[model samples]
Target: MTGTLVLAGTPIGDPSDAPPRLAAELTAADIVAAEDTRRLRRLTQALGVAPGGRVVSYFEGNEAARTPELAEALAGGARVVLVTDAGMPSVSDPGYRLVAAAVQHGVRVTAVPGPSAVLTALAVSGLPVDRFCFEGFLPRKPGERRGRLREAAEERRTLVYFEAPHRLEATLTAMAEVFGAEREAAVCRELTKTYEQVRRGPLAELAEWAAEGVRGEITVVVRGAEPPAAGEADAAELARRVAEREAAGQARKEAIAEVARGAGVPKREAFDAVVAAKNAGPRG
Candidate 1:
């Protein structure tokens, strides 16, 4: 009979936050696959459980290759437990491959609930959370990052992102450029920890603050665009925005692309907004 596969959650910040079930699983599993062996040791120490199972590393670099081995163990009736450095396994972490493989091999899969940064940040962010998208991380390259930000600028639903402290400034700057400097956003730092802080303001303002240097893990939440007036957009207003970005030295094509992406409108619609403005003559 195949044994069960458990995806256990670890504390995102404080160790005391670990759930009871997490402790139970750690002490009972036949094998514990951890994203980082060192961190797993720390967790075990924190929980004071002295992890009963044989601990093994299973991070992003080795997840794919090591999954089959783990799956085979599960099939052999090993109570396999998967844990990441923080939060639950397979969440922007490893374990997905092993879990999928286990399921395919007729092994049972379960979980031990615990803390989560994504939900915590969303709750603290001043932005809307009724509907939101969890975009784990943006591209590192400037152009690609900008393009991605622009694509979500006009998103009606709130947006969340994980960003490295070192790149927070550039990320916020690009967001401001794509989503409008005036767009509302919040930067959540060191969440759930003693120094936890959530700074809320316009994207441009956040960008300025970030340039001063930021540290610790970060979660950025951006407000979606306001509903168009009368539930319909103002064509003239849209036209003005397009022209303004263009006047700021952005190429017509590039400006339109950026505006379109941010506005969540099609490229053709943005192009037409500009065309309508140009055809309307000077607005003395």
Candidate 2:
């Protein structure tokens, strides 16, 4: 009998958010794989449950090397419980390789669901939640980050992202520049913690607010663009929007394409308008 590979979710902030099954699994597993051994020790201590098996660190640095060993343990009928410092494993964390290895080895895989920052932030964002996408984190590089925002400029579904506190203001400023200053958004910080705060406003407004400084795990939710209404499209407006995007550091080609799509107009018309505007020279 092949042992099961359990991917358990730890608390994001509050300890009570941990599901009852998590404690049971912690006590019963043959081996516990933790992202942070010290944090895992604290969690176990909080839950008052001691594992009957060995506990080993399985963080990003060692994930690749430790996966095979964990898979072997599962193959040998040792129940392995995998847990990150918070949230589910493999979600911007370590665990994908181990899970994939277990699946490939014919080992059964399962999850013990718990509190999730993504879902929690979305639920409280006050934005359309029916359709959405999770963009875990933006690139650290400014050019790459701006390019990514420009790519999602016309997305109609709500967008979610995790950001470091220090980068929040810059990110929001970039977002305002790309997505429009008036775009609605929310900045959720320290979710479920004592100092939890959700600042909701236009991208420009939030950008200015964040400039003052913020500290915590941050999740940003931005309302998606509303599709252009029938017969309301203006080629000039599309071209101007494209120009704004270009000025904000987005590639000219991408700006044109995104603007055209967003305005529900032909790309050729948008391109022509931009060309005409450029040829007309600077305004007096």
Candidate 3:
């Protein structure tokens, strides 16, 4: 029989936020795979739970090489508990590779629910959380980052992202450029910590504020694109709308449907508009 693989969530800021089950699991595990062994020690010290099992480092530097070893332990009926420095494992963290290995080995996997910077920031962001998407960390390269942002420019669902403090301004400026300067957003910094701050305003304003230098862990929540106003949309306008959605990675069919809905026009009318635009030669 295969042993279980537990993905535990650690406190993002306050150690008291650690789940009740976390301490028990840490104490009971056959082995603990931690993103940072030093931090794990601190966490265990805080919780007053000494692991009955061996603890090993499982971070980006060694995750690839360590996954197979951990999988073997699970296959050998070892109850392995995985924890990151903060938040749940495999969420823009370092547990994905191990989890994938465990699943492939037919090991049972479960999670210990706890605090999350993503959900926490979203909750305090004052943005619509009814429908939201987490984009994790964006590419560091300016060109690549902008390309990624452009792909989500037409998304109607609220977007969330994790960014480094030093790059917050650049990211926000890029957002202002791609999503429009007036786009509403919230910059959540040092969340759940004593210095926790949520600055809400237009993307341009946030960018300007960040220009003065910001610090600590950051999560950004941006409002989705507002639907075009209902009106009699001309062929050119409909075509332009469809093009924008397509440029942002939406399929033509879905884009046409959305454009029609926003314009309060028939889907067929939107289709016709797109066709008309195609038939007309490119604008000189």
Query: Model 1, stretches more than 4 Å misplaced?
Result: 238-271, 281-284
TM-score of each candidate?
0.88, 0.93, 0.86
lDDT of each: 0.85, 0.92, 0.91
Please state the error at residue 49 of candidate 3 in Å: 1.4
RMSD score of candidate 3 (Å)? 4.0
Whole-model alpha-carbon lDDT for candidate 2: 0.92
Worst lDDT run of 10 residues, candidate 1, spans: 228-237
Q: 1-284, model 1: which lDDT tens digit per residue? A: 99999999999899999998888898998999998999989888888887787989899888888998999999999998999988878878887788789889999999998898889998988678899988889999987786676556557788889999999999998888777889999999998889999999999999999999999989899888776666354567667667766554456887777666666678888788888888888777
Q: What is the lDDT of candidate 1?
A: 0.85
Residue range 1-284, candidate 2, lDDT tens digits: 89999999999998888899999999999899999999999998888889768999999999999899999999999999999999999998899999899989999999999999999999999999999999989999988999899889889999999999999999999999889999999999999999999999999999999999999899999999888777656766676788888888777887888888877778898899889888887888
lDDT of 3 at 153: 73
